[model samples]
Target: MVETADLTNHFLIAMPQLTDPNFSQTVTYICEHSREGALGIVINRPLDLRLREILAHMDLEADDAAVAELPVYLGGPVQTDRGFIVHPGTERWESTMEVTDGISVTSSRDILGAIARGRGPQRMLVALGYAGWASGQLEREIAENAWLSGPADPEILFELPHGARWSAAAARLGVDLTLISGQAGHG
Candidate 1:
């Protein structure tokens, strides 16, 4: 039997053929992956909401002038009301998952409090929700050509403009997504 490698710290780029409204033309950063299942956060697809709005809603005080305008992303389709913070740092938060040596995901409000105090991770993306898959589900989707996996680039996640993330992630594999057909082909 062939061993399946874990995809932790990888990026999953949606193929053009993927018409799922939740994931079409999106780039997802895999924070955890195992034989049991997988969990990731979409790096693109910002909603109309802003970080300030969320802060206000949660009654968490923040540096309003600095973070108010920051775009809040729609991480994925699952648990849309929950918040997730993908950031770079080793500092442990209340409910944090160390995704890689330099990156992590925090789901607790304490991190938000730290962020509000301007003491959080240097680079971070605040998002709501996350993508998830059952055992064997992601592997099957990859086999079906629904997504292309590649190494995760922190620059793409934290530095690039949100609209460019999808193509940028695909470009990492030398793929020009625009030229790809939406129809599936079998050899």
Candidate 2:
């Protein structure tokens, strides 16, 4: 049997027809994928909440005005109260996992404390919750034409405006989302 390709460091762009409010038109960055399951963060769903507010809620004061104002993303519907952070893979943190050569996801409170004190990763995207798929579930979804999978680009992941990530991620695969039909009937 051919081994299925692993999709770590990839993006899952919701298909145009995927109207589920939680995932509609979103680009999710895959952090880890295995036979057991998958974990990802929605890169384009910035909530009204900001990092500074989260810090204050945690009883930490912001040491840098700019970092505090950074937008916090609604990573996904799972574990909505938890926090997750995506940043350049740099420095050792209490709970940091290097998802790619230059990308890391930190979930420990120390990293957040560091961020509040202006000592966190220079570039980071704060998020709450994460998208998850049970074993074989994500593969099935892709096979069902619910998403477009492509290599995750850091520029689109961390640099672009939140609203641009959806199309930008799909563009990396040379697939124009606008051209994809919203109707989902097999020909």
Each prediction's whole-model lDDT (CA): 0.90, 0.90
In model 1, pairs of residues that clash are none
Compose the digit string of candidate 1's lDDT tens values, residues 1-187.
2235788999999999899999999999999998888999999999998888888887976775667678899999999999999999899999999998899999999988888888887678999999999888999899888999999999999999999999999998999999999765898
Q: Model 2 lDDT vs. the true structure?
A: 0.90
The digit string of per-residue lDDT tens for model 2 on 97-143 reads: 99987999999999988888888888888999999998888988888
So what's the TM-score on candidate 1?
0.94
